[model samples]
Target: MQDEKLNPSDETPKPEAGGAEPEFDYIDAEELDRLKAERDEFRDKFMRALADAENSRKRSERDRREAEQYGGSRLARDLLPVHDNLRRALEAISDEQRAQSAALIEGVELTLRELHNVFGKHGITLISPQPGDQFDPQIHQAMFEAPVPGTVAGTVLQCMADGFMLHDRLLRPAQVGVSSNVG
Candidate 1:
């Protein structure tokens, strides 16, 4: 067998000596340019895919956090009326009625306290605005507008019912009567 002469395009790279760079004498200029362009295209696609994957991961994480924080919103809303009724019952008990039904009142109080504890544990918080406080539409609902003595307009005349919040979101706005007193 004899050594055959090879074309420039078909030549294999020789072993490097003294840390010299490998020669690309085997490839024509057009073919080298083509390979460079192909490499650049692949690099661009890889970068875009990496960015998309990162964006998708971030979006999924945000969705999961929101579900964890606000998933029980409906149940929390439904339980509000029960809390309101219990509070009203306690408020309606006169001194004579309280003395006569001490045990029943105590039981109701205990139940309300337990409900409050559960609410606190679940990140439920009360938005109880007092009369004379400035009425904020974000957390307070104007049930009615009425003129009152010694109060400016847009002030809370009365908090008809309390509001609630779960984490950073508002569960319910505090129902209130706003002072319609003209400035």
Candidate 2:
């Protein structure tokens, strides 16, 4: 016998007289279905991971914006007392005191005006409620309640101190006296 190399292309399929030879296939229907299922699971996992990354990015951006807007809230809160004191000093000044020290009065007035300007520039607003206005617990704190004749209950009898708002947030509630009268 002569040595020969068998070539796959040279082989011919043989069939029986009444039946055909079955073609050998590496992958069957069940294995194909399994591969499709595995691919679908991987795709689903990848989509979930992608969505999580997007959500995280959005959350980080929102936090950064909030920090930028409200970062100085503590400092702003600390300065409220100074503003209150300065206003009280001006209010306590008598006409005789103003006449005696016109320059001092003017200086204090200028300082107070400048502080108001700064507050306005920084989105800080004053919530000054007048007497007889409706008392709102949302922005006003009841320091005291008294029964006053001819005054409706829950009305603001007196505004002891002004409230402050930084942007839309309350830095401090306005201190007030509410009427406890039934009328």
Could you estimate the TM-score for every candidate? 0.84, 0.83
* Regions more than 4 Å wrong, model 2: 1-26
Error of 2 at 94 (Å): 0.3
Q: Give one digit per residue, the lDDT tens place, for model 2 in 1-183.
A: 999988999988888677888678799899999999999999999999999999999999999987877788898899899889989999999999999999998998899889889888888899999989999999999999999999999999998899999899999999999999996
lDDT of 1 by residue, 1-183 (tens): 899888999976676886676765688899999999999999999999999999999999999999998999999999999999999999999999999999999999999999999999999999999989999999999999988878999999888899999998999999999999997
Pairs that clash in candidate 1: none
The clash numbers for all candidates, in the given order, read 0, 0
What lDDT would each prediction earn against the true structure?
0.95, 0.92
Give the worst 10-residue stretch by lDDT in candidate 2: 16-25
